[model samples]
Target: MAPSSPHRGVQHTLSSRGLAKLALRFFSSLRPTDCPLNCLGKARLDFNLLPLEGELHCLELFQWSLLYQGSKLVATQQSSQTGLQFLHCVMELQKKGIKFINREVESFKNIHLKDGTLEIPRLVILDTAMSLFLNLGAFEQCHFNCGNDTTTYLFFMDDLIDYAEQMRHLHNCGIMRHGLESDAEVADFFNQICKEMVLVSSRSYLSYLSKDVNTYFGNKWNGWIAILELKYFSNPWSIISLIAAFILHLLTLIQTLYGVFGYYRPSS
Candidate 1:
């Protein structure tokens, strides 16, 4: 007789494994009532009774699992004002001395603010991103249990990008990349995606982040520092000119003070 093929042996092993798994599932489904202990006599108990204690324990476990999962999705606290209103465009934030940094993570949920830098996960926009986001937004809206995470992200992005210049700033900062023809298209994509959609910023994951950004932007000192950095510290020549001007003013003040003192005391 010809030797059995190795292929047949492999198929037989897989088939046996499949049968074993099926038998395990089937046996696992049987309750203690369905397959009673052999020691317990039939007259001693009713097989029709449900296992109330085991069922209650299982239900409690399921509820706890859900609560644990929901807690993981929660971020910082809600803002007093609407979070969206506090979010300035990218250019505005840049002008206020807030730096934009690209986070290497793939998840949009990873956006955060630290110090004065806003770190956002890189978003790669393809031709299909619009449809994908729309479907995800629609699904989140229709399903009550599914949180509005995608909707919140879209709205947050929309608030950050009011025009092509803002989108270009985000791109220059490495926070966003797109295959769209122009920056204007990317700007329009975000602007249009969240149109007519109602989002409660207090419930958003980005609420606290937006509030922090606004606080930083509102500080007058940061604006002054930004202006100084832009006007004088941007290049070596500007910095030299500013230093020279400061030295000149200091020398003139010292000369005036020395002359007044010498005249008053008539020099010892």
Candidate 2:
């Protein structure tokens, strides 16, 4: 007869029910002040544990973990606004002199816009990303008190990426990296995940960021500057040609003025 398997005994000892009971007991032992959020908040307030500049604090780390766990902290405010519908695509924003900057962070909350520059954390998309986001979105929809942060993020990305070109722009800017076959696939992934999802703009953390971006995009001066840069200063050759033309025009104007002065008041 074959020897009894030790692995089988270990598996039997760690049954699903036993694990569930252990988790329940662990949670039950925690006091009201020991909740995850409360603990993180307390840690954040501790001066000794403060992180240096360019480092993430305790609460941010906790929020990042929650992001990967398919949940998020609840928003304190709620408004009747349906969702963010005024966001422009990547190319359009670029044409409006709105620059995209990669924050090089892993947290979803690391997105913000300041001084016409919109900073976003880098997003890595692998083969499993689709399933992961879909499952997270489903959980948010089904679980009570689970905010739709992930869904809102997906919607925001979908709005930014309208086609393959936009996806390529994001990849080139280091704001997104993907192992997909083509840029079109990445764009399609965001579009597909955001389909049929309801978004409350006021509840989304990116609402203010979006407003700031839109305000920058709406500025006529920015648009004019973008057009000038794209048309006349796009390359070294173009810039040199513009300078030469301006000099020629100035010389011609000066010559014409000198001749007019000579004609009006004859120089003896």
Candidate 3:
């Protein structure tokens, strides 16, 4: 009889060996920004799961976009009172009745719309973690509204767009290579992410992306905000200064740990 087939876990483990090497060798190299996308609008996004102090871990969103004709990094509207909002143009299309489409999305249409009459469907954005993975598979970039007030964002579109340009340049250079050392690095760094998903039953890895993206942005932003808020604190300068100093040191430590130390954020 032929050799027994590799168990799903074994296949995952084997596939993961390459990723593990990637992790040991280059995992921490993942940019603080977002994952890169390909010329075909294929990209992987991550939204780390951020748990709320209260109870529910709400799904957070990020954005994916493409650079049109020239090498342009598109900009979106921002507001301090609200938060980071992405895909305004696409969101507008919802008003015109365009529907977002994807598999594994619940009864709701894939596009962010409430009423699905389709004539520019109103943006019925669900706070679903699954959207991130699905969106990455579907679109080049996603639009995100992040930060407390929500104006802050983690835009993956530009990263992928930039990668696309680099790929084109490589293609022309006679040094064009099919596999990217960088993406391999990213995929490796994000191996834990993929591993976590494989452990689950969800065939669609998009939701995990949302979950990862959410956690990453939420924690980083909150940390920054706390740091910023402490800067102006003046009730008892000494006490505030002490606390602020600790926070500042922690921030730098985390950055350095992930940056210099590689592959570990030290689990804040």
Best by TM-score: 2
lDDT of 3 at 224: 56
For candidate 1, give the lDDT of residue 213. Answer: 86
Name the top lDDT candidate.
2
lDDT of 2 by residue, 64-165 (tens): 343432223343234224345559999999999988878754346557887778887777787877766676677667653456677777888998998999
lDDT of 1 by residue, 170-232 (tens): 889888888889999999999888894667665566676777888899999999998889889
- Per-prediction RMSD in angstroms? 16.3, 12.0, 25.0
lDDT of 1: 0.66
Q: What lDDT, from 0 to 1, does candidate 2 have?
A: 0.67
C-alpha lDDT of residue 18 in model 3: 42
Q: Tens digit of lDDT per residue, candidate 3, span 209-230?
A: 3333334334555445445545
Q: TM-score, each model?
A: 0.70, 0.71, 0.17
Better of 1 and 3 by lDDT: 1
Which residue segments of model 2 deviate by more than 4 Å?
Answer: 1-83
Each candidate: what lDDT?
0.66, 0.67, 0.30
